[model samples]
Every structure is written in C-alpha cells, then in structure tokens.
Target: MNAIFLMLMGLGAMALGYFVYSKFICEKIFKVDPHFRTPAHEMQDGIDYVPTNKYILWGHHFTSVAGAAPIIGPAIAVIWGWVPAFLWVVFGTIFFAGVHDAGAIWASARNKAKSIGSLTGDIVGNRARSIFMIVIFLVLLMVNAVFAVVISGQLINFPSATLPVWGAIIVALIIGQLIYRKIIGLLLVTIIGVVALYAMIYAGPMIPLALPDSIAGFSARQSWIVILFAYAAIASLLPVWMLLQPRDYINGIQLFIGLILVYGAVLISGPEIVAPAFNNELPEGTPSMIPLLFVTIACGAISGFHGLVSSGTTSKQLDKEPDVRFVGYFGAVGEGSLALAAIIAATAGFASLADWQAIYHSFGQGGVSAFINGGANILQQGIGLDTVLAQTLLTVMVVLFAGTTMDTGLRLQRYIFQEWGHIYNVGWMQKAAPATFLAVGSCLLLAFGAGGDGAGGMLIWPLFGTTNQLLAGLTLLVITVMLVKKRRPMWYTLGPLIFLLVMTTLALLTQLKSFYDKGDWFLFTLDLVVLAAAILVSLECTATLTKQIKANKASPATDQP
Candidate 1:
C-alpha cells in the first residue's frame, strides 16, 4: 500500500485500458473510419459547428468533464478502502466511462453533433426522449448549484486561495482578449498566463481574501454563492472565446502540473496508505459499498455527465471521427488519473493515520477539504514549499476545476432551456438573456432557497451522485439503442448499459430508503422523481432492444445501422 505503488498501478492500469482495451473497442466495435467525413465538416456553420484539432478538442472535453466530482468521489470512497476504490477507478474508467464517452461522441458525430437530449428522440422515441431531457436539465441545474457551493466552500475554509483564484479569472479574461484580438500569439499568451497564475498562487498567502461571516444577516457562504451565480450568469452569457475557452486551456495546463507535482511528491515522501485494504469502519448509516461505491466514485470510474460534455461542445468541435477515441475515451482516462491521485493523497499523504481518520469522520461535510490538506502535505514535504502556500495552491487548483464546471454548466443549461423553449413554443425563452436568467435563476433558487442551510450548495449536493449516475445509465441506454439500430456489434455498449442501469437503480433505491427513513420529504420527492425517470428509461430501452432482437430473428436481411 505504498502511495507510489498505488499511483503507478492506477495510472498504469488506465494506460493499459487506453492502449489495449480502447484499441479493441476502436477496431472491433467502433471501427473508426479515418476517411469518414465528420459532421464538423459536413455541418460547418462557423458558429456552433466547426472542425477543431483533436488536441484542442481534447482540452475542451477533458476540462469540461474533469471537475470536483472526480476529486470528491474518490476522496470519500476511500473511507471504504483504497483497494476497492482503486480497482473500480482503473477498470471502470476503461470499460464503462471510456466506452460511454467515446460512444456518445461517435453517436452524435454521426448524426450531426446533436446533443444526447436531442439524440434520445431519434434513438428511443419521443416520450422517453422527453424524460431523458428532463433528466439532463435537472442534472445541469444541480451541477451549477452544487459546484457553486463547492468553490464557495473552499473559499470559506481556505481564504488564502481566494486571491489566486479571483486573480486567475482576471488573467483568464486578459488571456481571452489577447488571444482573441491577436495582441499576442496564442502560445506565448498561454505561457504568460500559466506563469502569472503560478505567481498568484505563490503570492496569494500574503494577502488572503476572506469573506465576512454575515452581511445584514446573510451568511458568508450564502453571500458568496449568490455572487458566484451572478458571475456565472454573466460568464455564461459571454462568448466562449472571451473567457471560457482561454481559462479552460489554463486549467488543462494547471491540471498537468498538479498531477506531476502530486506524483513526484509520492516518490519523494514515500508515504504508505495507512487506511485498511477493505475498510469496515464506515459509519453505521452508510450504505453498503457495492453499488454505492460505484455511484459514489463516479467520474473517476464511469460517469454519464461526460456524455453530456462529449455531445455538448466537444462533438460540435470534433475535427474527425477517428479522433473521437483520443478525445472522448482518453479524456475519461485523464479524469480517472485525477481521481486516482485524489485517492492516493487522501489515504496516504495525510501525514498520520489519525489525521486521515479525522477527515473521514466528518467526510460528508469536509471530504474535499481533506483532499486539499492531503495534497498540500505532499507539496510542502516533497517540494519544500511553505505549508500555507502549498495548501493555498492546491485549494485554488480545486476551485479552478469547480469554477470552470460551474460556468460551463450554466452555459449548457442555457442551451437546454433554449432548446426546450423551441419545443414548447415559448418564444421568450429562446432569447439569450431570458434563457440565461432562467438557467441562472433556477440555480440560485436551488442553491439558496430550498436547500439553504445558510449555505450555497449544501441542499442539492446529496442528490448529485445518484442523479449523475442515473443520467449515465440513461445515456448508455440511448447509446445501446443507437448501436442496435446501426446493426453494429453492440456487446461493447449493451454490457455497460445493462450494468449501469442495474447499478444506478440500486443506488437510487438505497437513497430512497435513506430519505424516507430520515423523513426528508423534499429530498424524498426529488429522489422519487428520478427513480420514476429511471423506470421509464428502463422500460423504453428494454422495449427497443426487444424489438431489435425480434426484428433480426424475424428477418436476416435487415442489418445494423
């Protein structure tokens, strides 16, 4: 259980998945045709649709999908045991998430870069499609609220990070302007931005920016959430090139530096994972680890949200069909790597067994803080940085990840609102400001209204995991239907589809039990809604598969799409 050994094993397994398992998927299942003219070219409009280089697309896709969930999930999952979490992250990323992500891109690219929400109609019929869209809308809404709280939580607890984080945003806006206006070359601007960001990280501790506890009785956490959403409302309305894209590029580089630093720290510090191989000390009310762990450690292993990202912006920008495996599949493995690092840092790098245990004791409220503390330990011990500075840097890193996801989630929600507006014949909802307000307002209400504990994101946070995994299950269902229609070898998708459907359903059921036991009516209602959606999806997917099976049996001439 050495940290270095776990790092090497986890990363090595992801590499094997990418090289070996993904190769099998590419050749046999997808049969990616380099010659296939991707929709990026066929449907080029220069606005929403354009062919992008694979690497740039990967950066967009990777940062969009690699958010706090990966960090939070495994950091908490290690409470069960490092070994179970490790196995799931390595294998699940390869087989479940990797396949789902790549398949989503492939499905959408073939059909003209339509989103998973839109594609559901074609693959699963109108009714199921509508339910699926509702699921996506709900997922995105929770994402915005939850991540707002996540970043705000970091700001509340780690005030030293505030300067560097807000500083990075200003730098990102400048980077956006410079890169867009051609005042400076892209390569040089990026380098300058990264350098400036690191400098802010170093200087942040000297002038920490802390929020006051209350403003006219509004608590600091609540106040930050409101401000963050207001910022998100504007950020979502702006063009992607102005702020989103530039900042994402910076985030991608920062992520690489983080991974390298943590791994190097593991080597230098030589910490061993002191947590048990199979932890049995979880709190009494905690659900059994089997299905819960799979859903809990979602993004690191397999997630449905990646499908939204793959289909959301990445599909529109993808340059070629063959590049899908690299951007979609490999982006997933990249997240798995981040999650693995989180697991390593959480279980081993906390400096003492008692400290790690203390973090887990209140993990529901403070798991992510534990992750930051563990990572900070590595930075201080391995790289000779001041402990305060180290913690500040790591906290800012997590905040950037959360911030990007929040901004992007708002944007995606806007698109969903506009899309649904058209469907429902609501003309005003199709416009930018109205759509943006609706998206932002919904998030604000959810963040502060129903779920408020005088906190930004605490209310909707619990439902995020189950909803996320169920969304993945729903997306896989869509993919399976798409493959069946194509008459392609569908075992690759169908197996994962079945697995996710069962796993998510079990988790949802378990959650419902917990909600009912606690008499939490609001959460109980929402979980019931999601459970109903799952049932609808399962029925629709089952029917589609049955029809396809019977059709093939009825006629040998009909082939896959």
Candidate 2:
C-alpha cells in the first residue's frame, strides 16, 4: 500500500472524529456550555490558574501530553505490523483518547480544576484518592526522569539539534513576555517566534554544542540529565504565561510544521509501504500483540498520562467549559496524526521488505531513531531538502516536545505535593518553591541513585506502559461516574473505560509473571503494589458507581454531586 493512501485514510478518520464524533460528545454527552466560567477564572491566580486563550491552552495541552510517546510507541509497535498500529491510532484517537482527554478536562473544570488524583477522593472515596495519587506520582516521576534521559541522549546523538533546542527556550521566554504583557498580538508573536526558531534551526549545524565528555565525574549523558532537571526546576518555578505557555505554544506550532513536512512528503513521494500489513512470522521473544499493543501505543491511542496533563495543568488554564473539546479532544487528534506519521515513516521509508525487516528484527530496536532516519529520507526524497537538515529538524522537534512535557510534568508534580499538603496538613509542602524542590529532587534521586549511569529511569520504564494504561482506565472510570451522576449519556465514557480496564488488568498480570520469572524483586514488588492499587481503586469506584446508579433508578430526583 502507498503511504499516502494510509495517510489520507488516517487523517480523514481523525478529522471525522474531531468534527463529527467530538461534536456529538461535546453537545449530547458532555453538554459543554461556552458560558460556563472555568476554574481559570474562578480561582484566577497569576501562577497556575489563569484564563488562557483556547489556542494557547490547546498548544500547551497538546504538546505537554504528546511528549515522545506517540513517536516512540508507534515507531516500535510496527514490529507487530503497521496495520494494527495504524488502526489503533486512528480509531483509538476518535473513541478513546479524544473522549478521555476532553472528559478529564470537563470533570476537572467542574470541580475547581482539581488534578485527577485529588478528584478521586470527591468522586470515589478518600482511600481511592490516596491509592490513585500514588500511581499518579509514580507516573510523573517516571515521565520527568525518563524525558530528561531521552532529551540528554538525543542531544548527544544529534549535536546539530543542540543550538536550536536550547535557543528555542530564549525565543519562548521572549514570546511569553510579549503574550503576558499584551505588548503584541498572538499572530505576530507566533510569526516572530516561529521565524526566530527556524532561523536558529538553520544556524544549528554551524554551531553544534555538546557537554564535556566528563563533568564532575559524570559522563556526557549524566551531565545533560542534571542540567535538564535544573532547567525544569526553574521552569516549574516560573509562571505559566512567562515560560510554560509560550514555550509549549511555540513548540506546538513548530511540531505542526514538522508534521506538515513529513505528511506532505508522504503525499508527494507516495512511498510504498514495504512491510507486511500483518506479519505471521513473529520476531523471537515477541509478546502477544493483544494486550501489549494496547499498552504499547498508550499515548497515540489512549493514555493515562493525557489525563494527568488534562486535569493537572490544562484544566486550570481553560477559559471556558466548551474549550475542552478543542484544547483536549483536538489536542489528542494532533497526537494521533503524529503517530500516524510515525507509522508511515517507519514502515514506508525503507526501500524494501528486507530493509524494513532488518530494522524490526526485534522489539524496541526501532524507535525515535527509526522515525528520524526514515523521516529524514522521506523529507529529502520528496522535497529535495538536505538530509542533515531534515534530521536536525525532526530531532529538534522531538527534543522540544519532550522538553515541554517535562516542564508540565514538573509543575504537575509540584501540584501533587500541594495537594498532599492539603490532604495531610503539611504546610511546608504547599509552597511552590518547596514543592518544586521535592519534585525535582525525587526525579534526580531516581535518575542518579537508582542507576549510577543516569539511566535509572529505564528500570521503571517497562512498567510505564501498563501503569499508564491502568491510570487511563481509572480516569475514564472517574469520567463515567461524573456522567452517571449528571444523568448524561454514560456509554461514550463507559465503553472505553471497560475496554481499557480489562486490557490493562491483563497486561498487568502478564508483566507480573515476567517480572517474577526474571527474579527482579524490586520491580516485582512494585508491580504487585500497582496491581493491588488498581484493584483497590476499581473496587472503590465500582462500589460508588453502583450506589449512584441504584439511587438514580430508585429516585429520579435524587442527585448527588
């Protein structure tokens, strides 16, 4: 099959999802009211809760939730076949991801922009919230630690991306100031920011930068990790408008441009997909595609992390209730598009089936590297651009996406701490500076202490997929509960909720055996803990939902908020 055919089909599905399905959800199901004042206005603080333009908020939400997972997951999952990955990305975005993301924001905004962790208590019970928060914290910790490592490694491998990657930060700071001060219109700001960023991209190869081979006894990767965390801590401290919002906004625009280049290249070059649509000859040690595929393509299809981002930061910035459909659902569509592009690049960029086979000989072998090389080739072949420049563009795009996610992850971690303070009455933890310190410190400890080489985050990464999906299931459960309480159509949220829970539970059980068989006691215990938490939270939610449903059936007028 030609890549353009797949691209058009995938893009068309997502477009229908955004315009048709999402509208039904927003109107008939969620009943989003444009007049509804969101938490951004109700608790308008200049720091975390500020009324933001839907476009800017969408950029922040999209880029923050995107990170590198959509790229990495689909790129790697093609080991199964591009067909499965593509179908899941397209349909999952329409049904699962869009609904969950938009629903999370709606639920959060209705409840004062509470993080999903905190809102569990109100909807389910205190015990559920406590357990859910543990999973949420673990997810955040893994995201922060792993993204730092990812950016660090990418920088080292693609030195030409360094100048543009870091230089874009300065551009963001300037753009932030302009946006916040109302000194310039968003259009002009976007034009200026993107132009300056591209100029830096053009100059990047000429002024590539790298850390010393050893910094204070740390290798270059380790040194880069430390520096990244330091930048995240400071970014977390700054107000959202000052750095986070504008940075994400610009990065989101830049990523869209990158996507257009890759997608357009596919349309023009019309590369034939050399890999089989469905591979009967499986790689050695390949897990069953059933549960693994769902967990593997978490972000591109449906992700628990997207819930964290939606409720954590995005909800707080939503200007009105109706914007959730745009900022949350459309943001998800954007990610699905990226994942589709990744599937195309990884499958079609190679010249022949043998070449594609060589790259997918094993799972995890092909990831962002595959996307970069394959995408660079497509860009060169289709547009006649320099291969080196194309690589630099894609590499910088990945780095920026990861960087924006880390920024939001760190800030969300701080919010977690503040929520803990409110719950436990620990006054000190409520302060932003102290909370940020703890957030950064915990990630650093995990990175350096768990693994001396600064790859410690990888130790917990195997659990990330299942754990992330588990959380997504839980998030959908929360949204379903909200829908039931309001007498809204619950099937939209409930259907995906049931599917995710079943799949995630199966994945968790499968991993439990894998971890125990390997005699990895630490991960085994942690997995056991997470599985137990999932069960506990599920039970709590089920119990609460049962009561809500029974009460509704018993008394039509009895509504519990």
Task: Give all candidates' CA lDDT scores.
Answer: 0.82, 0.92
Q: List the candidate 2 regions with Cα displacement exceeding 4 Å.
A: 558-561
Please report how far candidate 1 places residue 72 from its true position, in Å.
0.9
Q: Candidate 2 has what TM-score?
A: 0.98
lDDT of 2 at 113: 92
- Which residue pairs in candidate 1 collide? 304-472, 485-561, 486-560, 486-561, 487-560, 487-561
**Ten-residue segment with the worst summed lDDT in candidate 2?**
552-561
TM-score of each: 0.95, 0.98
Instruction: Report the C-alpha displacement of residue 372, candidate 2, in angstroms.
Output: 0.5
Model 1 C-alpha lDDT per residue in residues 332-390, reported as the tens digit of each score: 99899999988887888676777777777743533676678888887778888788887
Model 1 reaches what TM-score against the true structure?
0.95
RMSD of each: 2.1, 1.2
Runs off by more than 4 Å, candidate 1? 45-47, 177-186, 215-217, 362-366, 451-456, 557-561
Q: Looking at model 2, how many pairs of residues clash? A: 0
- lDDT top scorer: 2
Model 1: lowest-lDDT 10 consecutive positions: 451-460
| Candidate 2 per-residue C-alpha lDDT over 1-561 given as tens digits, one digit per residue, 9 for 90 to 100 | 999899999999899999999999998888888888889999998998999999999999999999999999999999988899999999999999999999999999999999999889999999999999999999999899999989999999999999999999999999999999999899999999999999999888888898899988999999999899999999989889999999999999999999999988987898999988988888898889999999999998999999999999999999989898999999999999999988998999898999989989987878899899999999999998898899999999999999999999999999999899989999999999999999999999888877778999888988999999999999999999888888776889888989999998999899899888899999999999999999999999999999989978887873333
